[model samples]
Target: MGRSLDILLFIVCLAIITPTLNANKLESSEYWKEQRPEFDSYWQEKAEIAKQDNHAAYFPDPYAVSGNFTASISEIITLKSSRRNLKGGKGEKCLATNPVDRCWRCDPNWAKNRQKLADCVQGFGRNTRGGKGGPIYVVTDPSDNELLDPKPGTLRHAVTRNGPLWIIFARSMLITLQQELIMTSNKTIDGRGVDVYIANGAGFTIQFVKNIIIHGIKIYNIQVRQGGMIIDSESHFGLRTRSDGDGISIFGSNNIWIDHVSMRNCTDGLIDAIMGSTAITISNSHFTDHNEVMLFGASDSYPEDKIMQITLAFNHFGKRLVQRMPRARFGFIHCVNNDYTHWEMYAIGGSMNPTIISEGNRFIGPENKFIGKDQINAKQITKREYADAKHWSSWQWRSINDEFLNGAFFVNSGPELKNRPFSRKDMIKAKPGSYVGRLTRYSGILVCRVGQPC
Candidate 1:
């Protein structure tokens, strides 16, 4: 009896000592790598600043005029009278003074109205906007079959002299320019049957511009079979940092439209936008082969601007993707009208902020993979990313709730997948392998695996 009592006391002492030893180890633990506190603090401050900026967007300065004013032809003619280089005199022929002909200046009022007049001239000066926004034609790949090495100022030179632009296919040729394309405000890049492509550049980057349109172009094989493209990777010093060189990155712009473009095999998102970019519409495109499929409003600087107001519709999210489709950082983002397949991880992920609207979409996992209610990559996803179950999504907000409450999934089933079940029935029937897919139907819960079925 005494010996047994002594053994129990020893066991109790071990239980107490084990935790004390663990506590000591934790107290003296060395960090795996230095934490980026500076980066974190910088973004945290920017996120606060973004909150202020966002408030301003909703409630702009009441004193400032909402709409722009235009200058009359007479006003421009009157201003041109002061200039030395007018082909005709200032009064009757003042209308024909030709402000653009040479040295011409308009009244001081024109200074306030410069954008309006520039808008008028740029929109209607043979471009035929009929008093609305104009079109700027895309500079097609030169007719010569030779591929031009894209360089600095290529986009500037190609577009500097062009007007209210629209993309025009000068010819059907395989020409690749090795430079980033920049489109300023009031430009429409309509790639109507033209391959004005950049073959060996890093990536195509657009920034700080408005009223832009990118349409109908096949830009692929960008990351050629061997070497990686320059655009596949990029980083910024500001709070909005991630894979900066997405397939197509639109940043710090407003009211932008991107449609009918196909992107694949990029390192980052197929399309990514951040910071004060609003009223954006990305539709009718195909995305695959990247860590992030699409990202909206990264960084903390634009927190006030609320990256919530975006429309992602009618897009095809293809298969063989290892990365999460979207890892939203804040609220006010709407991801809708998309079809996803061959996804192994959570199709949509976000944290911290709220107001994420996800609807009218589909999340189809791998052929042998089924819905296992395991957080997308439960192994890889950090704890901080999940403040609550609402931080994750399956399809619509409703589905997110359903999944959290009842462990439901928005995937396919039945005879079409008879031969290819989530697990290998024969292999697991006798002995369940200790692989990713362990059982034929482990309590009917499906899980994502890397190798052969089960």
Candidate 2:
């Protein structure tokens, strides 16, 4: 009896100490090298590429407004009301309020002209030609029952093909991927007019590739996959380790756009872009019922992530979200025109001298003011040691034209940085936060029939 009691005590003690020990282990570079070797190698490769390309030239001021931009709250409201009444309103052209949405959603024949979405993206990742100028491939099968040899016409087969291709679904599907959907370069997964879903299984992994667009999909109930031999392309079948279970994992890639996606209830993060991924935009998406919603940079120690530039625009950070929308590190993040309805913890957070430009976002704090301490939680170097303070104090985290409701406030930090001056040649201003609801009304995947507006 005494031995059994002792064993129980030992078990309890082990449970208490194991997490702390694991936490310490995770902080070591060696731990990551062994556990996530792919991430480590990818980071190293990106660092080498950054050096060779002198990629510092690509880092633009995230805070700089695009083109000659100007908009008033009343004007945005008027535009939003007009857009809300777009359905069955004859002689009234489709007038999307946001620039990104306006780019593609305006076409009444959007279902037939699906590829037009590749042209509509704005901000940092505007140049992404996702399967543009490529042949269209349709996914006719929905089953993911076979991981080793995915049948032709399956979603798995469509994504694994080499080279540029525009992929569209033949019908609405609920795909539970057997393994991580390893995507190749120059692919566009367009789910317009379809109620396509990825749930109860693995999610997407965009790694070491470029020029991809994932639009109008619902990703939920994602669980980790114990990885194995997975076909990445037609010519390649490689062994993969376990996945982190993100709705979308963007790793060591560039020129990517993820728009109009609705994500929730993932085992890990809803969306995670890590390991020096850059030139990306995540817009017109809705997030709910998740913890650690988004994570941009992988580590604070990896300074090479300074090249990471992402634009988060026109997204709705919706109900029951805890934090990290997103938690950035060592990157240039432009968070604009997002509507934050609820956050248990702070909305945005970062360390490691990341430059975050929050503009025209509406932050509606939770009813419990104590939970929402600060809308923007930035690190202050003054409280740290002299060496750490000097380094962190130089970070440029600024807020402009942001609306804080219900006792919410932004905790600004770092150097006094000015918005880069611009000429009015072709400016575009983000709509006010008051219009966020209307702008992001159709933020998720649409269910449109053929020959109908999507």
Candidate 3:
């Protein structure tokens, strides 16, 4: 009888200790400890450089761009219903649709305060003050069609200028780029009050740069450009390699905010951020008809990508998109309040233990059975591969408050713990999945008149 009592006591102790062990597992991992120091050091160096150059430091105060939502939730819903009935009405007021839009779009004098957009970004890249300290450079010549020596007053010339600059177009223009438009650091290409389209030609390459904002433009129908001698800056001309023709290729850069742009039909990924890039927010944009929409990390084996933290907020993934809304590896991604109207195969797949927190998004699967069935196959393949490697359980992929329509489902895998790997306080609450349509209704390029609200 005494031996039986001792066994019961041991069982009680075991039950109490097991919870403690599980809770401390992530904190005590040697891999995480070793990586923590390197991550801190790299960001510290980048922060110092940003301070020295008087550039916007990455990940500034979250409340810096907070918006006052004047419209109530019921009012927003009624507006959405009214707008849906009208179909193509352009006069609808798009003031308080989302936090990003409400921050700057309500004012009638948006043209006069165009530079105020630099202060209205949220998420990890909130400090991306693109060309705020620089002079405004107006582009008068839309004639870079030859891809030869870019003349003065051209878009190419404005991008290749020496210092920080806010580049604005003189009029509505369709620029058929001759080669990939390589950008420098600290620039804002403001396309408000103009119909600017970069199509039927090359795309953009943002390599080894920082603090850039590309807003209010439409980029589509991009083809591969055989590389040649191109002018990067006024004083520096170099031979560039063949370009892959991504809508916006962000490589080894940081502090970028790409907002209110529309993209489709690129040769490669719509937006590819790789090679240790961090502090990026791709918000208030629209993407459609693209395969491999966004790729966050370069390779699965490159562990340095653990520093890559990007926030994809208030965007719209529209029709005919296949996989990789963003396929991340060894990074953290916050995909919040996006409207995913259609996807062909599957949405949001990754490898090498990336942390993906998908919150309050509306994912409407394809209507046809063929497409929905293909998503199941893709999901199973990813799960089986990761499970076989025995790395699936540790990766933190969570779906919270998401609306899955048309039998769509998110296959989440991770430790089922109350606490997340990252801090939840840093993120703002995303609009509910039901409200995504109203939030992202005005996703694409806006035609802003000088005297009217945009």
Candidate 4:
């Protein structure tokens, strides 16, 4: 313990003295246009999908009817209507509370039939089938020795492979990356059945890629990494810029899902999706001890993020989080069924004319810590930055059936879109916020043994 503390102090001192290096900005790179020529088309497809997700996806009318719903929406409705609280027979504790968890948890053979999770994603990223038909590559080594040419059986090598790959760990290990782990096209980093921690080092960078599922791992204590020659793919290695120290940076990616990960104390935001990244979902994860928790858009000037569509569902935002339990700009964010145990500042905030649908969330305000008198609007849950009541009042930021306690409240605006006529026949309804505790009981990385359920 003393040795670990000494090492941590040394790292902190190094950070204080070193010159600040910027995160990897692919746009500034000369290889941007050539490497990601398909950005325009991908942006359009994700925009269309986000436009379709406006209201009917959040609050479905049971009485309205039509047939324009796609097969994936039908699956969500089927799963929603079929949610049964399964009892653990003979003293086993089986608790698959939400629709996503019901899709795959409590299955004893999850290790053998890992691909079944591919069929389980919901919301905007439901179509993400990450590494479903790919070969499984087991990571036996946790070292990040070769930054340019990673050795086989390491996490770096597994994620940088071509085509599709389902990467798993051979045992419980801690991987302290020397630099950002730049990922390739199709990959699923499944850290179930053992503890896998990426800590005290650089985190992940999903830059200009597609189709990724990262589940059941812990990422925290991330620090910035300097730029150097790095191998990003099987047939590629180049000098890359420094990484911004995000726990997971999704830059210009599509069809991504980050689930069941526990994160805290990062130098930057825990999860940041920027540069027109779309078709993303962050669910069943636990976040704590950080400020600027998640950012869906890079900047207000970068209106290309108008195509960004994201889903924040079933996550638990825990203690010591100051703000930005996802601050957004120029995108559509569907935040549903999440638990906010505490927040020193506002819970959700945004700018630009983004469409934010917040539904069925439980917000428990922080206990009064002031000495003499209470802070003005200390328990206000929503914040609209740099906009007056006139402009943001017209933005489509609506709250539906959310439960607030301890003086917490959401100052909502725009239309009550739930009353909109439902044209799609297929839909899944959001459960009440009272059920958030039950749904998020098993949030964050699960403790799984091979023959037992996860």
Candidate 5:
């Protein structure tokens, strides 16, 4: 009896220490051969900050907005046919339907007043004023040859300059990176006015930084990069290990906004926000032709990700997506007003009981041949890895105002969610799924001119 009790205690102790060990394991690894200032304590600090972030303060409960959601849905259903798809053309007035687009897309002087886009972000990433008060640096060069000391006109130098900068491209250019481009804090890589793509090679690595915005870029066909002695910031250059090949790998960072970027065909996840990365908004983007689309939180064992809060709004999950359209764990995920057009396996799935409040998103299931028609859960959108239903029976996974077509369904579990964690006065409603078609119409990289409306 004593031996069994001892073994149980050991197991419990292992669970407690494992998360911390894994989180800080990078400090001892070859990732940072040149130790960063306060690097050892960085993970712990971010983890605690994530715990301190009050989800109720920013993330609105789907149940709290049900009445508004239902009314909006009915109103949209009445407007035209059930298959109504609204689009914006280059007509007289800018018909910016979604709130995010309406915030800035209508303005004719958008190029002159570029920083105004900084104030338009909503949801958990409200505080992210990325490069708002910074100088605008134009990237004239498209090469990534200088790994130790980047050229002045290149994208590498623009990101690693060590201050707030609104980086824009000189023209439409494709920058194939040699290695994972680690960036500094308070930067915005704005690809407006022209097309800027990071494709055919390595991708981005936002590791242990804060306040970043990446807008209007096309990132696709990301391959693995063998890490080497690379310059990350103006001050620090370290020995980086083998890269994960994600289109955007955000690790232990905070206050990030990825808007209007198109991502597809990555070796790993298209976008993976792991570790204790929080206060993020992935809005107005398009994703397609990927296996694992997104992953939130570091691992199932690492509970420090409980602090991660991300908003996925106004995006389109388009053709040939297999699974993990953000398979999240241990965080508050507000999937609001996005369009999921394809998913071979499952749309949204997780293992460790994530608080996923899906509101007003449109999900179209796999084609008829993929699943048995008679099976009830065959077309189910939610995918929990646990075998026993009892494990996640009480998990707070609710769906409100979500439109599930082509036999797509969501299995909701947990207590009565109408009461909501936060107060009723704090509740804010998103547009119903009927608005998704128009909201995500301009999802990918956009073309912008100097004086004309984008």
Candidate 6:
């Protein structure tokens, strides 16, 4: 029959292509059984018994936690909900709490709660004065009467002359007379801790307007051997006149607060917000000498250009044993926790574009840095070798690196001495000092959790 009709059409095309090739091999074995348990839990978290049973045994890892929050109210200040909130105050004990209380406890009356507090009034923005946890205006230098608005009011006559608000008592008021304290914000200048003495002839100037408040003042001798602070621009070139001494300027303002103030030896920059001073907050505060402490965006009068996030926390930097510090350019700096000690030369000098996160904050002794530009020589700077070792304790074991735990977002709970990977034949058959080139471990004395350098 014609070879059985061509073997019955090759057995009906192998019975219809063998079940469509076994249904594409059972859909690729059910897509690898649905990706094999996420590839065996990502190789069992890169095995080594789950990285030595989750590492981070202290060192400087005092339970590391960086920005935006992962734990750091200073590690729950004693805890009891942080001692029911840590109350303390200024004038008639300003208390009210819901979210009030940050005196760090010792209970000298338990006040604090002007909406929570935040206003040390730095520069100019809009007629100054806003609210939250009120009272904290330390803008000194109005010939020492201790600045209550040394003159100049507008913004509808400053809410009927300090009634739209009120809070001015500049520590014992002693700027002597360099003159220049033109506060045009809603206003508030309480220097509870005192030391607004800009003596040496004159030094003090805050212009324009906004919701201002400058806490705990301490400006020191402004003889002006040079130039220091003059934001949002506008001052004479000749010998720096203080039409009202411009020590804390912040023109074209907006929600400002320069807390716990201390701008030492003052030429400038204990504070300077320059044009467009928007939602700002320079926390803790304690800067040294006076070359530079804080300066963001140069400014072309009221020119803040989208002035974004600015929060330099904790604060404490140094410059007096002699003096000189402060150099700024861009903004967006959230230099966490802060603390940097007697730096002979520089820590973070200049070069602006701004995007500095920094984190944890601590940089102790022995200066000699060059960093970028390929100048990476290091004999010390890992927090000055555990604060000059010999049994160092809790400065958080100097710098610490394992690449800070590669790809770190903070709180990984294990590996991050500096990024641990090594394998170029284990870094050329490692043997010299059993490896120190990548910063393994040495914990303690790192200090500077919050002493502004942003």
> What tens digits encode model 6's per-residue C-alpha lDDT throughout 97-176?
11112332123321232322332222111122453333333233243332322233221122224322444433355545
lDDT of 4 at 97: 75
lDDT of each: 0.39, 0.72, 0.71, 0.76, 0.76, 0.36
Candidate 3 error regions (>4 Å)? 1-94, 145-148, 368-389, 421-428
lDDT of 5 by residue, 1-454 (tens): 6556655565455445332112222213443443343243544554355444433323444334333433343344355334233332344366555666666776768898999999888767767888889999999999999998999999999999988999988899999999989888789999988989899899998877788999999999888787888887787776766776789998878889999999998877789887778888898999988777898875666786777888888899998777777888888887888999998668998878888888889998887441122222337899998546988998888887789899899999877555657554444455667778987888988877776667
- Model 1 over residues 36-119: C-alpha lDDT tens digits? 332355445544554443333331211011000012222333453455432332321212222221221223232222223222
Position 43, candidate 6: lDDT:
34
Tell me model 3's lDDT, rounded to 2 decimals: 0.71
How large an RMSD does model 4 have?
Answer: 8.2
Model 3 compared with the native: what TM-score?
0.78
Backbone clashes in model 4: 1
Off by more than 4 A, model 4: 1-93, 371-376, 419-421, 424-428
Deviation from native of the Cα of residue 434 in model 5, angstroms: 2.0
TM-score of predicted model 1? 0.49
Per-residue lDDT of candidate 2, residues 116-152 (tens digit): 8888786678678899878889998888876767898
TM-score of 2: 0.81
Clashes of each: 26, 4, 0, 1, 0, 81
Model 2 lDDT-worst window of ten: 377-386
Q: Rate residue 132 of model 1 by lDDT.
A: 23
State candidate 4's TM-score. Answer: 0.82
Distance from true location, Cα of 308 in model 6, Å: 26
lDDT of 4 by residue, 1-454 (tens): 6556655565455345432223323323443534343334544554455434322232232212111112322344345445454533344566777778877876767888898998888767766888889999999999999988899999999998998999999999999999989898779999999999999999998877778999999999999788677788887766666677789998767888998999998888889888778778888999988866887786767887777778888899997787788888888887888999977668888899887877778999887553223222458888898899989999888777788999898888887664556533343345667878877888899998776666
